[model samples]
Target: MGLTLQFIPYLEIEGLSSIGRIRKLLNAVKENKIVLLEGRLRKEEETELIKTTMEEINSEFKGIELAVIYPESQNMAFFRKAKQHFINMLLGDRQGLTIVGPASVVKEIKKDPNKIQLFTTDVKVKAKRPSKKKKNKG
Candidate 1:
């Protein structure tokens, strides 16, 4: 039996300049291995970008799933509200596992039995700072 999984893409849009990144994201979705997409859409273009991505993915992966993390514009909340309806739209009442974070997402995709994968040109940066050197006091 094929395992059902949720593929969430965690993207960071600095400003109104993520159009190229969005296109690359949609292109990745077209590969048909992704079950769901979960990411923060912080710009006005995000909705449209997601719509277009869904359409493209559907064309290839028929019945492709999409779960988005759309935070309220005014409140600046951090994933507090769960849109259960969106999960229903994709998994059809089934509780799917969420592949969060950049590394986890890549690991999940690589482990899928279907073996569908998406490639991107963008690079992910680690948020942690390098360890400081300890001074030797003689």
Candidate 2:
């Protein structure tokens, strides 16, 4: 099986409803495509996405692993933090990256303040050999 990575820009999902966004992300993940979204989803939307994924979990569709990476604000100065918050509010979009991938394919996702590491599992497929037939002439 081949792996596919799908990139979704903020504008593509900016105007979508909460459910619409979740559906889009979930659909991509279900198809074994890792989705790299430009911006992060709201807390409520994230919760809803998990809920929907849980409901759809089955044998083929194991689930999903989601991660969000953003600049660390804990060590930032008060003024700088304020400015970041202001910018996010003004743009109505969080300055971050969101990754969503199927649990079957994505083994793990590790993140720190500076970078993200995604680990994937290799899927093994068996190829069938064609049968050989022998013809007899009398």
Candidate 3:
């Protein structure tokens, strides 16, 4: 079966605080669910997220893997840049995504100038059993 994913901050909610979003994201991570965050977190928030995740991690539970992606700017207007900078400052983090989850399923997070890659692995195929000979009774 495939995993069920949920996106946060993708839609504009009337009343949603940064802390609220953080809580929702954290809860989903705790349940081992994949969460797609729209934007990046502030520096303080990033630190907090790491701290919290580290605390929950242990022998059985692997630590969370974070992949921060700074998307290419499409509209480089002065106004747009100013607005983005203001928002980033307010949140105390850069513009990107914060992914958190168990490392058993998530690994080899790669990033390029074009895009980000996650979950790279080698697949092993099992060999089939040989058919038995019809050495019937006499």
lDDT of each: 0.41, 0.89, 0.65
TM-score to true structure, per model: 0.31, 0.82, 0.67
lDDT leaderboard ranking: 2, 3, 1
What is the number of residue pairs that collide in model 3?
4
lDDT of 3 by residue, 2-98 (tens): 5545666634321456666566677776676666677666567677777877787777667666777776666678888788778766654435665
How far residue 46's Cα lies from its native spot in candidate 2, in Å, is 1.2
lDDT of 1 at 134: 94
Which residue pairs in candidate 2 collide?
none
Q: What's the lDDT for residue 96 in model 3?
A: 69
The candidates, ranked best first by TM-score, are: 2, 3, 1
Give the distance in Å from residue 67's predicted Cα in candidate 2 to where it truly belongs: 1.0
TM-score winner between 1 and 3, please give it.
Answer: 3
Separate clash counts for every candidate: 1, 0, 4
lDDT of 2 at 79: 98
